[model samples]
Target: MTPALPRFPHGPGSRYTARAAFSRTRPNRQVRNINLAPLVQRLTERDQWLAWMLHEHRVLTTQQIARLTFPSIRTAQRRLRILYEYALLDSFRPLVQSGSSPEHYTLGPAGAAFLAAQAGCDTAELGWRPSHTGRIAYSPALGHDLGTNELLTLLAARARTTPAQLPLWLSERSCVRRWGDLVRPDAYAHWCDDGWREMPFFLEYDTGSENVARVEAKLASYAAFTAATGTRPALLFHTRTASREAALRRRLAEPARNLDLHVATASADFTTDTPWGPWWLPLHTPTRRLPLAELASRWPELSPAYRPQASDDADSALGLPVPPLPPSDQASRP
Candidate 1:
């Protein structure tokens, strides 16, 4: 029974033996594959485009990308997922109406790289435009803009009329630091004494649509500003809206009285008088082309009076005590 060739071993002509032989050699025939970095690099480029798109735009949804002119919707969506997988994009899925998807994406590190690489691309270039209003004209650190230039011109002109007018105290645009929750007033001025002293005044440009809550918050901000700098700053609110202007005046008068601080309003027309020492004074901004210089001309007198000292001796520079800031928030000057 053991003889007779093991009963023709399954399939025809010993196919079973042939398969076993091939299986034993198959392990030796295997080839090793390497070089995954190039594949990863190619994937990264796709993610880079998605990142760039997100970095430049605001609150874009998946559906929005499908309709954009640059990339086909499917491609955009696929690429966005790649970016998400790579952590190059940050996504937020807010709760909305039932059946509504609240997914939104923004640029992450990879997106920022794409933004930097694409010359002159920033939050502004991506269509997140800030209105021209509320922009500061000049700060030595933040640099000068039209608003800063205009304000300086007005300040320079006003200094010339006073019998006790001091020289124009000027802090150039570069002197302030820029960062964090800190704010540097648009300009630091003085009744120009040769000391180039700092009369702490913060100029805020408001373009209306700012509500009561905003005003209150800003009042708190003023309180914070004074606390950080150790000086009572005159907040010069500028606005084109008459209603907002009037409301600001009313709000400031009450809170300022409570806090023993001063907040005033002005307009671009230069005709609106700025209040001084609780007395409404008709102020004039000089018409000269070189206003700061004209303001500086009086520097001999003004700088000496308003000059800032590092002595850490004086209690209050503005002659009024600043209200203590709230416990949770601290103000810092930049």
Candidate 2:
């Protein structure tokens, strides 16, 4: 008799074998030729806005861009493909062990030139040095930056549906320009709603990579910022784990003398729900997670200097409907 065939424990159809087979046979699409002139001519104001955002933020994934700029994911993907093909945006896929990572995009040379002309400045002045951007694209801090951006992108998406508007999203670079000596927040945001006026905030995104002592040191800097400006914006710390949140809270509880500041901490998992919802646990009151709107109530002592101005032009620029303002103190929270 012929030698018995080697025994197969789970036959030849195990899940692992099937996955390997599928991976080997997976289809890869070829890049399609695109007409440059027509694509450039078809670019709309919104498209330009997207490019400007990329230039400012350095890099954003397709999902983040979709949430921030487009009405729907499908529309975003279609438009992004066109933009990519026409060389208005450059993208790269990071190496991952499992499923592919979302393509992260940066402003292309042509797009940068267009923005430079629009701003009446040179590309270097607009911070569009290709080499520098490329370096940033692959930097180790990229994940931290992306995490910070995702928080803002979620707010932008909410603005499209709710009666809220994120009128201003200042990048870290912009923050440095404004207050580099005092502190550099991951990002600064101004939120406005029917009830709430422009409420400015400083976002500190923590990925649990830094030591707790370092985080506390940063808090000291924010405290210094509050003392100088006399306008203490809420410091929102988005940490990577519950343990990190606990550790941060402990450090926050024992702040330096004469350093009274408002701070809130939340884990990264909270992003699964509405980012502006009751996700933030204020250090002053660690028992409950308060919504973004209610954060002001937690710090009644803070007299914010930044005020939201009434402007039809601003509303139009954001493409949001102007809601009737309720009769309430512009500076006071109800």
Candidate 3:
């Protein structure tokens, strides 16, 4: 027979400690404390946008959401905690050995219901089921998806401070829905600055988990897409390492030789620098690193799509002011 474990003696005033211990032991049950009604009432349009983005992208880390939506990490943490408590958001921290991983968030049930009500449709019609969202949060591709969003988050943050223009951003889901059959870029963006005229590009964010040959094969699809559409958008490949970049460049040399497409490569090592800075090197000229704005000069024959028209109503929906175009001379530079 095993000896009984000794129980610590509790003083007469230790009832509060016992209750606190019970609460700690049953944290998952704390959802009962959330008041959903008032929480919904407290949500603003910006908050709603955060929910929509979560629904669209599936998952976003605390830092990514902070960069995309909030002015600071502290503010994001406080607000996200309230949202999480009220069931408007759900979060999980991936296991790491040393430092704690940042909390990653997905849309919670209450947020789905709120969005459905706003759309005048059933929650099912909003393409949101909490179970499904939860599963995706734990997917193997979670890191890749977050990395792709990180690129856009960086762009959004830059737009807040710099004169660089990110006129349009389309997520992978949006791309697949729109062009699923042809080629689905990880993300699509348009960059225009005083130095670089206008560049509409397809972003392929590689985590180095994929085979290099498989990655290089994507150029053929992009080439076929250009042929069909008669419009060739520059292809920007952001890889995780210099070795992968070299391999991709070698694989791309022959296939891209005769295609009308323009390819540029950049490594994730330069993420701390301005994403639009001189981090990108053309596949044809690997030695030269060009800022995004100066890339257009290299391909004079390729005509970029016109910038998408944005109205006052659209600007209001985006929650950002559209920067005025630079002077004609500055914008018209080669």
Instruction: List per-prediction Cα lDDT, in the order shown.
Output: 0.38, 0.66, 0.68
Model 2 lowest lDDT segment of ten: 14-23
Model 1 misplaced regions, further than 4 Å? 1-144, 157-182, 191-200, 269-334
Candidate 1 local distance difference test against the native: 0.38
lDDT of candidate 3 over 211-298, digit per residue (tens): 8788877888988888777777788999877887888888887778777569988887765547778888888856678887677778
Model 3 residue pairs with clashes: 196-293
Off by over 4 Å in 3: 1-40, 301-334
lDDT of 1 at 190: 42
- Cα lDDT tens digits, model 1, 209-265, are 346557656666556655665655445566544566666776666665565455545
TM-score of 3: 0.78
Of 1 and 2, the candidate ahead on TM-score is: 2
Task: Give every collision pair in model 2.
Answer: none
TM-score of each model, in listed order: 0.33, 0.77, 0.78
